[model samples]
Target: MDTIASLFSFITTPVSWIIVQFHKLYGAIFGPDTGWAWGLSIVSLVVVIRICLIPLFVKQIKSMRNMQALQPKMKAIQERYKNDRQRQSEEMMKLYKDTGTNPLSSCLPILAQSPFFFALYHVLSKIASGDTIGVLNQELVNSAREAHIFGAPIAAKFMDSEEKVAALSASLTDVRVVTAIMIVLMSASQFYTQRQLMQKNVDLTVKTPYMQQQKMLMYIFPLIFAVTGINFPVGVLVYWLTTNVWTMGQQMYVINQNPTPGSKAQDNYLQRLLKSVSSHGEVRGRRRRSVVQAIVAKGADRNDNERKFFAGLAKAGFAAQADGTVIKSDTVTADAEAGSAARRQQPKRQSKAQRQSGGTHQTGEAKPSLEKQQDTPPKPAGKSSPATPRQAKSGQRKGSQRPKHPSSKK
Candidate 1:
């Protein structure tokens, strides 16, 4: 731990300077030597660092989602080159390159924060050893050493000896209990954050190794924290716990607002959107409009949740347009009802009497006449009527032809 901290020694001065600045602000209200002053300083430092890492966090999210989407292609490449390790590596790189994905992007926030973490660790370690480092002069160091957070000195560790804890004006039992509770809280917070992410935000429809890896990390991360937490000072634990809570809250906001397309978060989001749009008869906000626009752009490719959303809109007599606006569509509903009514209507059946009479039923409706007299002039008394010239050329009669007796066929 010392070696690692030394590797980031250059950052210790800046980290200590920031903490001292925050301590000055908090110390005035909470007392310069109180736990709240020092503990909140650490927390403030974490907030400042995390806020600066927001861009990296966003890139991490994009990278993780992109990795999930590329799993099938990655799996295919692995299978095709199962026997060729070098070629498989090449193809994997090609896939990542073409997709503009960096597998390491997901680690950017952690990597970016590590220097500060180690620098803080080093500073606290020095305070524990009664040494002044960075901008923490002897007077500030002495005050920090005397700062007790919930009966435990800020620089005390769970593994600290009784003598060391006594020297810091705290009992061993008090220090151990405080540190234990903090460690447990930190680990639990970490676990819950990852679990929330896996359960609500991940796209479960795609079976991928990326999901498996995430699940593994869900368990692994908390365990790692719990194991390493014993070595962390009480102040470091506070820093980690505060950061974990911040991360959880940030993730919840993202999952609620702009979740993955096929995730449960999206389903819930769309349901809420459906209710809002149905109540107001329009999309309410620019963010919601963008969401609707994307879903509309998906068209037939939309998932079940999105399809249900569209159906709900239609049921409310609202139609979503390509530009993400909803409009009342009374004509669409009326046309649908009219078509259904037409399908349900059957033609009136003709009775045998009506068919035989070839005239109207008792109703007053008129039927067309099949013939007025025959177009021909009255034939001479004894002369047989010759076939019409048009009929002769056509080789058949036009209207109904009489059937000849079978035995008298020509």
Candidate 2:
């Protein structure tokens, strides 16, 4: 036990030094007397450690994706070697080696975090007893021992609640209550983050050994944390809770942007992208349809108006020929002498229903009708017409105005 303690102490020395440096930095900012400074220092230390482990977290994500990709082959190996356990293990190992994937890589982040967790636990526990460990002097340890996060000392534990209360001359109920709350938060955060990964990011259809292990851990790790959190110091709980929060946020980002191929998160991400694209396409299609409908309706209205104008002209004793030419009422009477020739030259006019319903006729007749109406000769200098009022006014202005010679300007 003594040899083990010495080895553990040696392993935890760097963690102690880091905490000491952070405590000094936070103490300078928040004042040495404030207990929350040391508590914040512990949290900052956790941030630094998690930041350093980002590459490992990325590796873990890649490994998980690789594992999901390999699920089919792993299942095949298992089915082929159901009666040969040794052979199955060998095949699985060979598969992992060939794929350059480590079944344990997903656990690397957690495994790496464990020693730091224990080290922080050790440092906090030793400092609480006023021990000079690593770079932490007696003064700093005393200040750390006195540190409180929400009235619970950084070194306080649920298991040692009574001892802490008595030692600080504080209320036993307050310490216990604070300690219980921290444990609950620590355990719950860890549980929630781990459960989120298992439920969302993992593909559940494959029954490989790795997937089975994940399934077991989905329940086991949380249970372990819930049971073990009672004995953890408040500072250690702070570190864990902070780390779990970081993990949850990081995992959520990964699940959204780079989900595992066969996972629910990936499916959801794909569905969202496809939905957005389809919705945009539908909107553009509707817009195009609406534009076409409006243009067709406008053209129909214009055709109807032109037909009414020409019919009015025919009723008032003028005639429009199929060649899009209009003959005056006086000329129509003169042309009556060649009625047989006129009838032979004129094309048959279809009924109003046919003219209105025939899209091609309406489109073909519109431009020609407009051109003939524009080319119609001015009225025989007698009556004013409502449609040509602007032209009549312009003609009167032209008759009244005379240009002066440039010599008059001098």
Candidate 3:
């Protein structure tokens, strides 16, 4: 009975079965010593999984856009009922109801991938630990154990996670450089994958506070992957790194063909990062100068002022683009307008909805005469005051002034 159950379990374990096939495939295709196959297999698997997650990723992006769109109305509700928590809750609910957006939709893809990520980790760990005999058939185990993919033991640094390596591995062999490179690439690529997804695929509208929150999460999430990448297996690292490269390519295709409103199709993080890295500290300084110049350019030809200001920076070899503003591209238009001296001098324009709401609340739109005030007569300027004892003593005059009534409007 135990043997039968074990056979059924063995048949179901995809990783174990795949590991068996990998050994045979490598042996048959490229001979016994050509060990690059394992890495390629891992990369292929990662790509397959990422492709499968595409729908989820698309859904996440759509939901996130909806969330961003709802943010302005939610903020208005928050402000309108700032002191009344109950009404604020009601208003918030109404806003969400109208917008059909949920704040949590942003995390759907990540949540869906959690189990697969853990499963992959476990599968890779098992193979790398040299305990494949039970997980895979004996023939497959023997063949796999002899395999040296990338000149390192397939199972060499499975749980090591660190490049420093264990004393046991050092006594047996040295693959620190390979393991370290793998780990770094894995971490860096994961960072790039997440960063690109957010900066490209996500239809993030920054007009709302919710979108800013998403932006903060984007950086925070990448930072997390960079920190946690150290703990994943090197094979897992390769998987991650490859998956990221795939995502970058996939997202690039999507963005290039159908870019988001605020995104630039012609440029990418690689260009910016490479420029920043190559220029030492000069890129950032130039960026600040260019922004200041662009702002100045909107009003005056501050070229002379900029020259004196940025003369010390000429040695840095990075200068503000001469026509980045003057030439006018979509990227530069918003920056030139808002960051400009002209915009600072000009008052902001109010929206039509705001004007209508303000008029309804405070203008003559709701004007009506007060019936009570209209009905009450003022004391005659030349007549004696009614409350005086002398005037009261003239009872006929006081009695005559007090009697009047009308039918209720209700």
Candidate 4:
């Protein structure tokens, strides 16, 4: 027993030293007589330890996610090798190894912190028994002896009592009450964290062994804490309670920001994001409609094509605006119109005679001929001439002669 105690004391020395240093620091700030300072020092120790274990926490999350992802394949393997336990175990281990994930990695953070918990537990236990152990000097020992949280000693246990009956009864009562409260709080925090993961963050569709294990642990951890809390020193209880709170908050943050896929929390987050985007789009659409209305009210005579385009935008939940146009641009439309106008302005092809005479007619502008107009002598009443001066100038002859008047018929 002595050898074991010595080994425990040696292992706990560093943890006790850190706690004492923090206690001193808090004592300086809040004054030496404040019991809450020492209590807070234990909490600070938990914070320091948990902070150092962040990498393990990350690994745990990654391993759990990998396990969740591999659930289907794992189920298939189990189904195929139901009669062959040895082969099934080998296959499962092979799968885990190939994926670079250890099924036990999820327990690493808690397992790593167990030694520190035991160290603090041993240090506080020695102080409660009035012995200065390990790195706890006489000053820290005196402070530990004096520290009381709500009249309950920091190193006190629920079953510990003084020699005198009156003192024993009061001390036991105080210790029991405080321990009960701390146990409930610590157990509740742990339970709540697990509940959140199962209810909000875990995929219900997956009935894998890992998820089942998590559910089982949910009940087991709280029961364990409730059962064991009475034996823990007040300072150790404080450390555990604070760590529980930290874990709950961390789980909440993960559930809110990066919830497990196909989970209730993920669905809720996606729904919220979609609603926000849709609301923003509606507001922008309204603004665009107002702008388009303003442009139309200003009597901008938009062409049929422009009107059709704006109507299409409206139909597609988009709106046109003077500043924020939502359709094919006015510049492009203007360029097309300008091209059509240029085509209309081009001159038409001239006739062969006009080309030979070098008398081209510009578009919508005709030039007069250089030849003078001549009147033929009035035809005799009985004349039947077949050619006219115009036809003669063109070197052409009429095929039929004009008929004589009826008076010349005889």
Off by over 4 Å in 2: 1-6, 275-410
> Taking the tens digit of each residue's C-alpha lDDT, what string does model 4 give over 174-256?
77789899999999999999999999987767666677888998999999999988878788889899999999998998888
Candidate 2 per-residue lDDT, tens place, 34-90, comes to 766888887888899989999999899889889887898999999999999999999
lDDT against the true structure, each candidate: 0.88, 0.71, 0.54, 0.73
Q: Per-prediction RMSD in angstroms?
A: 5.6, 25.2, 19.0, 17.5
After TM-score superposition, the amount by which residue 408's alpha carbon in candidate 1 deviates from its true location, in angstroms, is: 8.3
Candidate 4 segments whose C-alpha is farther than 4 A from its true place: 1-8, 83-86, 162-170, 281-410
Report RMSD for candidate 4: 17.5
Candidate 3's C-alpha runs over 4 A off are 1-12, 18-27, 32-34, 78-94, 133-135, 158-174, 194-209, 262-410
State residue 174's C-alpha deviation in candidate 1, in Å: 1.2
Clashing pairs in 4: none
lDDT tens readout by residue for model 3, 123-193: 55445554553456544544444555455555555335444344223322344556667766655665666
Which of 1 and 3 is the better model by lDDT? 1
Q: Rank the candidates by TM-score, best first.
A: 1, 4, 2, 3
- The prediction achieving the highest TM-score against the true structure is 1
TM per prediction: 0.83, 0.64, 0.51, 0.65
- Ordered list by lDDT, greatest first: 1, 4, 2, 3
| Position 120, candidate 4: lDDT | 80
Q: Residue-wise lDDT of candidate 1 within 151-217, one digit each (tens)? A: 9999999988899989999999999899899999999998998898989988765555567777887
